[model samples]
Target: MSHEQLKRTALNNAHRQLGARMIDFGGWDMPVTYAGTIDEHMAVRTGAGLFDVSHMGEIEVRGAQALALVQHITTNDASKLQIGQAQYAGLTTPQGTFVDDLLVHKLSDEHYFLCVNASNTDKDFQWIVDNTKEFDAEVENTSGKYTQIALQGPRALEILQPFTNVDLGAIKYYWFANGTIDGVPAIIARTGYTGEDGFELYIDPNASEQIWNGLLEAGKPVGIQPCGLAARNTLRLEAKMALYGNDIDDTTTVYEADLAWIVKLNKGDFIGRDALARQKEQGLTRKLVGFEMIERGIGRDHYPILIAGQQVSQVSSGSPAPYLKKNIGLAYLPMSHVAIGSQFQIDVRGKLTAAQVVATPFYKRSA
Candidate 1:
């Protein structure tokens, strides 16, 4: 679909005015980059960057049974989440396949918010509502009620502190608070997808443009650039973060995706608990692993993985690391060959190039 036909965020006009290269991202007309992907990526890694992530889904579960409803649908132990804290989790199908990964924020005893993938917004909302029918909770699809902006990197706090009266210092990582930005009531969460010390600001759609511009103006002196989806993808990939539809999908299991930590099989009877438990005991047949190309070639999505020169699996997400200056990617291979230091081959444009499995988070910033 054309960009004009796609859904627009509050900052859509600003992005276009800034000469951003816009692209159709899951029916949303979003910027891919303003200056360049690598430049924006470096800006976020070294300094700061702002991302207009208003396309993501915001859902609310409220009632006496909110906690129980959420815990039953998600793979993580939502019951362990205290008020104001957030936990990364996956909503899995009955067969233990991931429907979508999300961040569950415990707003209160009877209220919880789930930030879900942009593309899976409707599906996730429907899933939650359908599943919660038996519970006393009420589900609301709040996707259109708010716009989200991620101010990421080391300087993010400095840029944001000036606008809000909230004690920025008191807001710990993975926690949130009701606050105001430029006189606009909002929710500020010390969370991000880029693996950086950052915050995601949930603002009223009416106040989104003002906040976006205010952040850019305030951050310009500190070298904070308005990043786009291109940089966001690379940044998350470098951090070994999973992306829906690419790294994980409805057909992919959380265990095979190396996200077993989020699957709380013992957290009572969750939707996928039994299947996940079986998989855990039986062992995963295939697993996702990070690989770096040893030869001179860039491995990309769907690239064939070879074991003993025979095709074994394929890459799910691949890109040249702008930060590491190396070609890196994620691929699913037989569990036997997923160990670090295991050698393999990847088909890069019909040529079998040598590659090796390596530990993830290819780049980690110093504290």
Candidate 2:
């Protein structure tokens, strides 16, 4: 798509003002770097990093059968969620493949808020709407109404605490509270993609630029960097958080992706419950696993994976983990070689490079 055809977020100008290098990420013109990926990456680890995630999508489900609609389409047990809590979930297809991975937030007994991937927003909205036909729920694509910003890293709380009246400490992980930041109404959720102690704020779009700037100013004392997507990608890789199109996609089932934890079979029927149950019984042919470059090379996305010189799988998401200071990636490997310490080779530019399976969630924050 042409640059002119790409969508722009509300914080577009704010990013440009800081001399951000913009890139075309899934039809949206987004910042890829500001002070550079390594600098931004390390900032989020040691201090804090503010990210303009306004490109993400938000959908609202309400009315009498809202919970019913949520339970039917998503794999997580929404019935167990309280009004202020959130849970990670998969929007699956009847064939047991991912439509998208999303965050489901319970706003009230009759209302649920969902955050979907940016590129799949329209399709997911349509899917949600189509599924709601069987229930008495009203679905709204409210993606345009909010700006999503993520403040992540160890010092996140210290930097964001002064701006919001939400009592950031009170909101535990995956929980959210309705509050105001700098007098702007917002939903402060203690969630993040970086696997750090941080918050994702869903706020009014009109106040996006203000919030973005104010946070930067407030965070300046602690050396908070305005991070872009490249840093975001590397950070997520280190944490082993699945990226929708890269790590998990329409053709990949939750089991194959090694994300079966999101599937609650006892929660009763969902979009892909039967297929998943069968997959569980039959066992997996191949499943996703983490690997580290054994040789001095970086495996990139879509690079061929060779077992005994025969290509079988492709690297799903690969990068040099900035925090770990090592090259790592995720890929689907046959069950015979899925165990940690199993070896394989990655065809990086026609040269086969050695790699080995490793324990996933390559990095974890201290509790």
Candidate 3:
């Protein structure tokens, strides 16, 4: 998409004022970098970083059948999520593939809030609305009601604790609480895309700039950098977090993506339950696996992956993991090559680069 036609988040001006290099990100005009990709990336790994994630979409499901509707749509068992908690889930197609991976936050017995991919928001909202017609539920595209900010890193709690009324340390991972931040109502969740100790806050759009500036100012003592998409990508890659369009899509199943942990077949008849059950019984032919570059080359996204000199699959997500200081990526390979230490070839440009299977979640923060 062109710059003039791209969508802008509430913090667009703040990012630009900080001299962010803007780019077209899934039709949104977003910052690709500020200081630099590596510098911002290292800062997040070492200290703290703030991200404007207002472009992510939100869908609200309410009414008596909220849990029923949520369970009917998501692969994860929403019944397991407590009122104050959230769980990662996939909006699965009937064929057992993801429409989009999302977070289901239970607000009450009758209310569920979903955080969906920015690019898939409209489609996801429509899907939920269609599903709600059969249940006693009301679905709303509540994306515009809030601005989302992510405060991430080891020092995140220390930097953000002063602004929120709720105890930051008390909100365990994957849990959230409704509270006031800087005296403004906010949903403070101990969740983040980066595999770090952090929080994702949803607050009024008008209050976005104030909180954004506040977090940055407060974090200044701890070297908090205003992060951008470039660093965000690297951080997530290191942690093995899947990127929607790249790491997964409608063509890939939860099992094939190595995300079966999120699939709760016993949740009782979700959209893809039967298909997933049959697939599990039949066994998977291929699955996503992490690989490290054996040669001095980077296997970028969509590059052809070969085994025995023939194309088997393509790299789903590939990049230089800044924290690990190595070229790493994920791809679907035949089960025969899924074992660690197994080898494959990634066709980068016109060159066949050697790669080897490796353990994932390549980076994990110290507890």
Q: Best candidate per lDDT, number?
A: 2
With candidate 1 superimposed using the best TM-score fit, by how many Å does residue 336's alpha carbon deviate from the native?
Answer: 1.3
Error of 2 at 124 (Å): 0.3
The pairs that clash in candidate 1 are none
Model 3 lDDT tens row, 66-161? 999999999999999899999999899888998999999999999999999999999998887776589998999999999999999999999999
C-alpha RMSD of each candidate structure in angstroms: 0.9, 0.7, 0.8
Model-by-model lDDT, in order? 0.92, 0.94, 0.93
Candidate 1: C-alpha lDDT: 0.92
lDDT of 1 by residue, 265-334 (tens): 8889999889999999999999988999999999998899899878998889899989889999998889
The better-scoring model by lDDT among 1 and 2 is 2
lDDT minimum window of 10 residues, candidate 2? 128-137
What TM-score would each prediction reach against the true structure?
0.98, 0.99, 0.99
lDDT, ranked from best to worst: 2, 3, 1
Encode model 2's per-residue lDDT on 13-56: one tens digit a residue.
99999999999998999999999999999999999999989889
Q: How close is candidate 1 to the true structure, as a TM-score?
A: 0.98
Residue 5 shift from truth in candidate 2, angstroms: 2.1
Off by over 4 Å in 3: none
Backbone clashes, candidate 3: 0
